[model samples]
Target: MPRRGKVVLVQVAIVLSLLLVWESGVRAGLIDPFFFPAPSTLVARIGEWMSTADFWTDVGVTLLETILSFVAGIAIGTTLGIWLGLNPFAAEVVQPFIKMFNAIPRILLGPIFVIWFGLGLTSKVALGVTLVLFVAFFNTFQGVREVNPVVLANARLLRASKWSLLRHVYLPSATTWILSSLRVSVGMAVMGAVVAEYLGSSAGLGHLIAQAEGVLDAAGVFAGIIVLSAFVVALDAVVDRAEKRLLVWRPAPAHEV
Candidate 1:
């Protein structure tokens, strides 16, 4: 097999072995399943959810909120980040306000959102957007400010106008920071959606988990978590692809830890 294929097979084997051991340990009564669910049980519960309409609706609501919130965050954050990054004076003036908002716990803001937007989808989406916006904004802002002066000078030597400098120099320089923020924002978006649901909502995975918790259905809680994790992984993969496409000009060798 090719190297990548061989590595994938090894990973599959490792995962399967771990699952078997965990399930065996639980079934043999050597391990408790209450706090930690076996992979088999989680899988079975997920399968049951797949067979239900309510499950799909919950998933849809969560996905809708996550997508809308993430898109809004990106639009607002990117624009603000670029603006602040290009203008040091603006950055300095706005620094305290930004810091104050960032310092406040997002969970505290969730309640106000609930009161303002009620138990509707708007509240959940707003919370998610708030959570993701700051992350992207800060990163984009730094990316802009950190553009190399030598590059700007070279662009100036070529008689590049402000528009040309922004397009060619600032944007490319900040692409790294924006992409880094995107990776993190993907998870934050999901978290915001779920937390909003937990506070008060009639549907969605968070509400589902809350209901299951009330009934002491440990397996169901694990099932909801597994679903959310899968959603996060999938969205992160999408962001990774977009980053690769948008920043194709940047050589990969420079990004090593």
Candidate 2:
């Protein structure tokens, strides 16, 4: 077998063995299943959840917030990144203001969003936008700034119009960075939605977890967390696939499939 294939197989074996040990430990009471349920129990919860609409509703709500926030973040961030990056004066002028907002903890804005947007999905969407936009913005800005100066000079010398420069130079240069940012920001988007829900909400997995905590139902909390993790992984995978398609100019890494 090839070295990479062997290494991957070994890694999978190790993970499977660890899961077995964890399951055994829980069953033997060496670990408290109440606090940390076995993987099987969580899987069972997933099965039970699939049988009902309650879980689906919460999942849908969270997904809605995540999608809206992600779209808005990328749109706003890309526009700002491209604008600021192309104009040195603007970039320098706004650096401090951007950094100041970035430094603030996004979750703290949740209650305020709730106050302004209410306990509906809007609050969660706003919080998610706040979390995702900064990440996307920084990545895009860095990407644009890092574009080879020689390339920009060449494009300009060739009489490229403003629209042509953006399409041929700026957008292409920033594509990789923007995609990379999206990959990481997807998890943050989910976190923002959950945080907003936690602050005030009538629905969403975060709301369910909050309710479980009030009742001290560890299993339910764990179940909700597991559900959220699944959603993040699924969404991240989608982004990865889309990135590969959009950034076809990039060669696949030797380590990636």
Candidate 3:
């Protein structure tokens, strides 16, 4: 088998082994099935969800929120980060306000968002954007600031226009930092969406998990968690592929760690 196939098989084996051990422990009364549902029970619950149209609707709602928030956060964050990077004086003036906002607990903003945007998709997306924005912004800011001073001086000597300098010098240098934040921001976006739904929402996987928790259904909660994990993995995989494609010009390391 190819390396990728071997890696997949190893992953499957590890999961299956753990499941077997967990199932045995539960059956032998060493573990409580009620508190910690068996893998089989969770799988069965997930299968039931897969068979229902409502489950798909919930998944779609969460997926849309995640995507929308991620895109919005990246767009806004990158623009501001680039601007701040270019103008040190403006960045210094805005520093305290940025710090104050970042220090605020994002979870606390969910209720406020619900009040402002209503208990609709808008609130959920807003919550997610808040979570993703800081990560992208900080990374991009650092990337731009870390650009080589000598190279920038050379560019100035060459009489490069602002647009040319930004396009060729700033953006290329910051691409690494921006892409580094993409994977992390995507996960934050999902968490923000789920948190918003859990607090107050009529739909989405978070709502489904909240419902299960309300009824104390361990299997249902576990199923919801598994579904969410799968969703994140799928999204992260797409980001990974995009990062590779975009950074193809970057040279590979001499050795893998």
The prediction achieving the highest TM-score against the true structure is 3
Q: What TM-score would you give candidate 3 relative to the actual structure?
A: 0.94
lDDT of 3 at 163: 98
**For candidate 1, what is the total of clashing residue pairs?**
0
Clashing pairs in 1: none
Question: 1-257, model 1: which lDDT tens digit per residue?
Answer: 88788989999999889989999999998889997778888999999999999999999999999999998988888899999887889989999999999898997788899999999899999999889999889888888888888988999999999999989888888878888778889888899999999889999999999988999989999899889889888988999899888988776786543
Model 3 C-alpha lDDT per residue in residues 1-257, reported as the tens digit of each score: 88888999999999889999999999999999999998888888999999999999999999999999999999889889999998999999999999999999999999999999988899999999999999988988988999999999999999999999999999989989999889999999999999999999999999999999999998899999999999999999999999999898889878743
Instruction: Name every residue pair that clashes in candidate 3.
Output: none
Q: State the lDDT of candidate 2 residue by residue for 1-257, as single tens digits.
A: 99889999999999899989989999998999878889898778778878989878988999999999888988888889988988899999999999999999989999999999999989999999988898888888888899899999999999999999889998989988998888778988899999899888999889988988899877778888888888888998899899879988877689864
lDDT of each candidate versus the true structure: 0.89, 0.89, 0.94
Error of 1 at 107 (Å): 2.0
lDDT of 1: 0.89
lDDT-based ranking, best first? 3, 1, 2
Models 1 onward score TM values of 0.91, 0.92, 0.94
How far residue 119's Cα lies from its native spot in candidate 3, in Å, is 1.1
